[model samples]
Target: MSAAPEVKSADANDRANAISTIVLGFAADPMARWAWSDPSEYLRIMPRFVNAFGGRAFEYGTAYVTEGARAAALWLPPGVEPDEAEMDAIMEESLRPEIAGDIGAIMKGMAEHHPLEPHWYLPLIAADPTWIGQGLGTLLMKHALRRCDEEGIAAYLESSNPRNISLYERHGFKIVGRIQSGSSPVVTPMLRPAS
Candidate 1:
């Protein structure tokens, strides 16, 4: 059998590949589709959204990739956060006006459910569609959770796709609450307590 894929910190050189993996992984995701229903819009805006939402992982050396960027996880260390300003700007410019209120409510709910205490946040994790079912997701999760365990700090993530809840649970995460708004898909906020 081939050796298991090794997880490594993603550098700037890996940004495009890593982000593309996430984009393709989320193509069928309910929350993502609800936000950008048009295939063209999704293709155009998702890259910016990924960068705004989890790009810090790249700068902080917390972005992990494996199998030649076939899978990626963007984890924000304690006190680090998404670029809210850029995210807001992107949404304001790209989202359909009719769904603006729903989007706002969803964002508000996400913030309300977010843990106030410092924690590692996984804003995004995905494997290229063609690479699914190969343990890449579990590999990435274990690689990051190892650090969380070592530091005795909690880890948090919101599941944008219901299909992924079980995968996160398998890694020690528990659903703490849910976030939803008019015409929007449910977003499950999960937390893994410190070891």
Candidate 2:
């Protein structure tokens, strides 16, 4: 077997490539497509959405990428969070009226399922379509979860694609609840207790 890909903390120089990988990885994601059904819209808005939702991981040195930037995971450490205001603005300006109306319920559902205590939140994790069969996802997960385990802090994430649920479960995440807003795909909120 070949050597496993290395997972490293992504720096500012890696920001564009890392975000582009995630954008490509999530191109067909149900939740993402539901919000931006138009191909043109998805292309235009996804990068901004990624930035608004998980860009802080880069600043905090928690964003991870595998070799060739084929996979990425953005983990927001305790006390850190997505830029809610920017996210709100992005959705407001981009989503269709029908989709925009559901944003409130979707946000409420996410908040309700989110852990109240301090924990690491994985807002996004994905592998480029070209590299889906490789072990990059598992590699990235282990790299970040090691830090969470060492810190004795819990980790959480919402599975936007059902195909990825098994991968998260294999990494010790358990589905706590489901979040589904009007005309939106099911989002599974999962948590991995502190080890």
Considering every candidate listed, which one attains the maximal TM-score?
1
Candidate 2 has its poorest 10 consecutive residues by lDDT at 98-107
The C-alpha RMSD of each candidate to the native structure, in angstroms, is 0.6, 0.9
| Clash statistics: count for each candidate | 0, 0
Writing each residue's lDDT as its tens digit, candidate 1 over 1-195 gives: 988899999999999999999999999999999999999999999999999999999999999999689999999999998999999999999999989999999999888877898899999999999999999999999999999999999999999999999999999999999898888999999999999
Cα lDDT, all candidates: 0.95, 0.93
lDDT tens digits by residue: candidate 2, 24-46: 99999999999998999999999
Clash pairs (backbone) in predicted model 2? none
| lDDT of predicted model 2 | 0.93
